[model samples]
Target: DPSHIAGKREYLYEISQKAFDMGMEGLMIESHYNPSLALSDANQQLTPADLSKLLDKLVIRYQYANNPEFENQLELLRNRIDSIDSELLEILASRAEIVRQIGKYKKEHNVTALQINRWSQLMENRIKLGEKLNLSEVLIKTFFQLIHEDSVRMQTEIMNS
Candidate 1:
């Protein structure tokens, strides 16, 4: 994300760990001779000494692609994910219902689906909340934009039909 000063580095490390754990094909890191005096992003830059220390601490996990235990655990996780997906679908459906109601009101009042001011407020508020919740601002913004686009599309259809 590299967007926020506080969360960026921590979030970077976290995703790097996950990527390696999930058996990513390649990994790269930047290390400087002296991070404190680095030319750019000094705070995020790691000295070779610091990088070595971190590399020493990291445990390169096995892929476990064919391990029976991994398979079993994967199955259990998939089941849990299935459950969560069901719940998420229900929630999204409810949101869609609300969107439809809003569309109906907007249509009756001859209002446009696009509300730039409300969208701007949502972008700011949701992005701040997402950062507080340890989510990348880009991630939250992209997600909101997607849902907002879909809502707009459906609302437009409702108004037209």
Candidate 2:
């Protein structure tokens, strides 16, 4: 998570400490050099050096806890969770990029930006598929809502551009 411009490191350290005290295994943070050049979250991206410093502190604190089995379990779970999250993010990014392309095509062809009927059909099919896969209807609906909203926004941006 991002914090105010100044004291971000202190703020994050406090947060990490609190989380640790509350029995959290760890945290996930984003970092970049020359954060000003970042495409997303430019203002919040920490420098590599700063990120390393934070990690060092976290490592020391974690080791001081002296629960090797707990640490190992946390590491394994975190790695697997991160792997799944990365794959999901990749898929979403690819989908968004394709939506942008579709918007460009629509603009060049003078097509309308939205097709409500098609979207409805897509949602219905996805819901059925989710059910077949043993997913809750509510979860399926919520997921599709988020995906559809993002797709629409992406396509709209391309069309306007």
Candidate 3:
């Protein structure tokens, strides 16, 4: 991400701090004895002294806290997340089954698996619904595109079989 930083050296420390806060165990920081004389990525390359100072300033957090109440609340929230994930997997399986049935129907009717107009409509509807649910449009579009691709692949397989 040195290129993305675009000579803003301060951002590197901020990003490293954020990564540490996000539970990253280690960071591969570029350093040199004389960064000003470095051939590549000189802007991002911190001198050894600066690197040491940056490392000292960074606060690494442990994954688990020692507080029992905090741990209990975290466990409860994690359990809820696990339950939701299970439900999501079940829903995806059901959707895949329905897609399989649709594939069979398409094969019987001699219809194409990919209908451009249908895909366009589906994307529009799904994007709007996702936005209403406070989800990012890009995330919804990418997620649905992946699902649609898999659905099309399934139908194509059925057609070939």
Candidate 4:
């Protein structure tokens, strides 16, 4: 983070303030008696007095303020997220069922469950679609890999049985 901050003390102060305002419990700011002579991360290390000033400027925001309007809005947003999560679970369940059927078909036909070419093609298409939807490639790949692993495991079990 210091490398990213690149000796910008003002940016660090702003970021720290933002984090505090976002209801972070605590922060670990590096302070030294003399920052210029500090052995490591000299660029990021603030003098004790400077650190104290930064701390004083930080406004701590409470997670649960006694404001009815804010609480109500927060509750609404949380409810929406819960609804989306429920729908996501339902979709995953349906996908799992379809995968099980595919596993059965593969078992009956003596076909391998872990088809590398198909997986590679699926990943390429999925990454493209994910990028279009503004999703990270890492997230898409990891999610699909987990699903594929489960599908392979299920198919292997069916074949063994």
Clash number by candidate, in order: 0, 0, 0, 0
Best by lDDT: 3
Off by over 4 Å in 3: 1-10, 31-35, 47-59
Better of 1 and 4 by lDDT: 4
Error (Å) of candidate 2 at residue 8 is 44
C-alpha TM-score for every candidate: 0.59, 0.54, 0.78, 0.72
**What's the distance in Å from true for residue 123, model 1?**
1.4
The TM-score of predicted model 4 comes to 0.72
Q: Which stretches of candidate 2 lie over 4 Å from their true place?
A: 1-71
lDDT tens readout by residue for model 3, 11-98: 7778888887888777877888998898887777888888889889988888889999999999999999999999999999999999
C-alpha local distance difference test of each model: 0.79, 0.77, 0.87, 0.84
Choose the strongest candidate by TM-score.
3
After superposition, candidate 4 runs with Cα above 4 Å error: 1-24, 36-44, 49-59
Give one digit per residue, the lDDT tens place, for model 4 in 1-161: 42235465556677787777777777767778997898987778888898889878877877787999989999999999999999999999999888889989998899998999999999999999999999999999999999899989988888788
Residue 19 of model 3: what lDDT? 80
| Models ranked on lDDT | 3, 4, 1, 2
Residue 138, candidate 3: C-alpha displacement in angstroms: 3.2
